[model samples]
Each structure stands twice: as structure tokens, then as C-alpha cells.
Target: MRDYLIKATAFDGQIRAYAVQSTFLVEEARRRHDTWATASAALGRTMTIATMMGAMLKGDDKLTVKLEGGGPTGPIVADAGANGQVRGYITHPQVDFDLNDKGKLDVARAVGTTGSLSVVKDLGLKEHFTGQVPIVSGEVSEDFTYYFATSEQVPSAVGAGVLVNPDHTILAAGGFILQLMPGATEEIIELLEKSLEKIPPISSLIQQGKTPEDILNLLLGAENLKILETMPVEFSCSCSLDRIKDAIRGLGNEEIEQMIKEDNGADATCHFCNEHYHLTAAELDQLRQNGELQ
Candidate 1:
């Protein structure tokens, strides 16, 4: 099935929640980046959480998430729009490591335990929202949990995971975020805490072919859960040849002339999607004469 996300509320609107199934999206990222096992797990986890965070926004608003753990994987950069579209890349996508003591992917080792997780939101009106927290754990999930409690000052329970096949492709990927809204009673919080303890790992559920609603039912139960909105999610990039061409033009006519004289053409690649765009010498000449990229 295609990837999708669901937004819901529980306990008479005292609790807000989101759940997502992101298998194909994460797999697409793994294929595009050629990420190894541990790298795949870390990147997938970040992308999963970032996608859910994107669902929290309104129209035309977007957010950027950065995981600079100072490990071999370098920094993980992801951007998501309110429409459930997300794209990201790890600076070093080839990093890998052996399983940890729990026999899980060694994401912490690959991601490092130092540095921080920072989020910047473009909310329009010449204003932006920023929140950052020191990395308490290199594991992506706990780091985000800390971010919620400290940076955003929201009492939230976050869980995200990605399972990689033997060949390093993503087998399953998913996550959930449960947030406490105003007037949440102590009883409601306690109930959610206990319920979370009894559920299986999110990745395990996704691997077993569970939907977002099934996962939400496991987290918040069906009786009190009210599904609000559901939207499709994917690994989508906003880069194109025309955009790259404009960037080349912005480098000024001298740069374009040099490219024509030395390399015969220019080949540019996007950091987010790794898509390549080439400009031939003839094209460069046209751009040089046109003044503005067409």
C-alpha cells in the first residue's frame, strides 16, 4: 500500500495524536542515497518523524529539521510541507555499524550522541519559529522526545523506527506522536503512559502490515479515538532543471563563460534529491546573452 498519515484526537480532545505508515517513502530514500543498514535506519527515523511534524502545520507553512549528531552520518537535513510531502538527505549516507546490545540497528553510533536537533519553521508574515535542544540520546526517537519536552515545551510521547532488509533496503518504517493538550487530566495521562507500554514497536507493526489506524488504536484505543484527517505522504523533492538553471544564472555571466571555456558544460546536482541537471555550452551561451535564465 502507498504511504499515508492520519491525524486524530482522543479523550475528548485533551490529547492530540498523529500516526503514519512510511514504508515506500523510506525505501525510495534508501534507493536514492544508497544508504547502508545503520544509515538507512537513522535517516528513515528522521524522515518519519519529520513527516509527522509536517502534518502539524497549516497551509503554505513548512518546517526544516536538522539532526547534527556529530557522528559518521554527518547531518541529516529534512524538510516537510503541510501537505505531507517530505524530502531529506544525510551528509554521509554510507555510514554503517554493527547491532547494539539490544540487537537493534546501531543508530546512536552512526548518528553520534553529541550536538543537537534543531527545527525551523517558515510560518509566513516575515516570521519563523525555531526550536533546538541538545541531543540527549543519539537514537532518533528519544532525541525527538527530548526536543518536545524541552524545546517545544510540549508533553509528548514520540516513537519512530525503521527496519532494513538484509540488502539494506527499508523493510518497514513508521511512527506516532501523542501530545497532551490543555486540560488533560492526570488520569488521561496515566492511561496513555500505561497503554504505550503494552504496545509493540511501531516498526514491527508496520512490518506486519498494520495501518495508521491500527497503530493509533493500539496507542489510544478505539473507544476514545476520533480520527480527524488522513492524507497521503511521500518522499517528494522540489528541485528541477529550471531551478538549477536559475541558480547558475545567479552566479553571473562570468561563471557561465568560464564553464563554457573550461569544462564545455556544467553539471549540477541537488543536495536534497541528488538529481543532476546539465547545461550545454550552447545553453550557457544562450543564458549569457539572455541576461535572465529562461
Candidate 2:
């Protein structure tokens, strides 16, 4: 099935939950970045969670999740928009290691525990909303859960998982986010916590052909869950050749002239999507002229 996300409310709106199946998008990322097994798991987990977080916003709001764990994979970054669009990348995509004792991809080793996870949100406001939390666990989900509890002052349960195939392609990737709304009763919280302990790993459930709705039913019970909305999710990068040209133009005339004199043309590649763009000598001249007008 195509990738998508569902937003739901449970326990009479006392709990907010989101679930997503991100297999296709994660696979796209693996192919684009040529990530190894462990690196694919790390990037996929981050992107999966970012997609759900994106659904938490409205309108043109967007957010960026930067995870700097000081591991061999370097930093992992995911950019997500309210419309269920997300794109992400890892600084070092070839990082991999033997599976951990649990026989799971060694994500914690690929993503060290020395750094922090920070989120910057552009809500179309005067100042962006920024929150940060120390990396409690190199595991992506725990770090995000801690971010929500410590930085945002919201009690949340975040679980994201990615299963990579032997050939380094993503086999399954999905996640769920559960948050306690204000005035959540003690009984409801207790029930939710108990349910969490019994649920299977999100990726495993997705691999078993479970839909987002089914996942929520397992979490909050079918009787208490109310589906609010569903939206298609994908790996979407907001980079374009025109945007690259504008950036080159912003570098000023001197830089453009130097490029024209020394290199004849310019080549640019997007970090998020790995799409390359070549600027011809004539294009460089035009950009320089455009810069002159500004």
C-alpha cells in the first residue's frame, strides 16, 4: 500500500495520537543516499517520526529535526511540513556495524549518545519555536519522547522502527506518537501505558500488513479511537534549480565572476535530495546580471 499517516483522538479527545507507514519514503532515502543497513535504520526512524510531527501543525507551518549524536553517521536532519511532506539526510550514509545483542540494527552505535536532538519550528510567526533536549538514548524514538516531555512539557510516547533488508533497502518503516492531552485522567493514562507495553514494534506491525488505523485500535482500543484525518506522506525536498541559482546570485558578483573565470560553470547538488544541477557559463553571467539589479 502507498505510504500515509492518520491523525486520531482517543479517550474522548483526552489523548492525541498519530501513526504513519513510511516504507516507500524510507526506501527512497536509502536509494538516494546509498546508506548502509544501520545508517538506513537511523535515517528511516528519524524521517518516520518527523512525518508524524509534521502532521501536528497546521497551514504552512514547517519544522526541522536535527539529531547530532556524534556517531559515525554524523548528523541526521529531517525537514517536514504540515502537509505531510518530509525529506531528510545523513551526513555519513555508509556507516554500519554488526547487529546489536538484540539482533536489531545497531542504531545506537551508529548514532552516538554524546550529542543532542533539537527541533526548530517555523510557524509563520515572528520567531521560530525552538526546543532542545540531551540525547538520553541514541535510539531515535527515546530521544524524541524525551524532547516532548522535557522541552515541550508534554508527556508523549514515541516509537519508530525501521527494518532494513540484507541488500540495504528498507523493508519496513513506520511509527506512532501518543500524547496525553490536558486533563487526561489517571485511569486513561494508566491504560495507555499498559497498552504501550503490549504493542509490537511499529515497523514489525507495518510489515505484517497492519494499517495505521489498526495500529491505533491496538493502542487505544477500537471503541475509544476516533480517526480525524488521513494524508499521504512522501519524501519531498524543497530544492530546485531556480532556488540554487538564487543562492549563487546571492553570493555576490565577485564570486560569480571568479567562478566564470576559473571554472567556466558551476555544479550544485542538493544535500537533502542529492539532485544535481549544472549552471552553464551563460547561466552564471545571467545570475551575475540579476544580482546587479538587486
- TM-score, cand. 1: 0.98
Write down the worst ten-residue block by lDDT for model 1. 285-294
Q: Best lDDT goes to which candidate?
A: 2
- Give the least accurate 10-residue stretch of model 2, judged by summed lDDT: 285-294
Alpha-carbon deviation at 290 in model 1, angstroms: 1.8
Candidate 2 local distance difference test against the native: 0.94
lDDT per residue for candidate 2 within 1-294, as digits (tens), equals 999999999988999999999999999999999999999999999999999999999999999999999899999999999999999999999999998999899999999999999999999999999998899889999999999999999999999999988888888999999999999999999999999999998899999999999999999999999999999999999899879888998899999999999999999999999999998888899888883322
Off by over 4 Å in 1: 291-294
Model 1 gets an lDDT of: 0.93
Per-candidate TM vs. native?
0.98, 0.98
The residue-by-residue lDDT of candidate 1 on 97-144, one tens digit each, is 888999999999999999999999998858789999999889999999
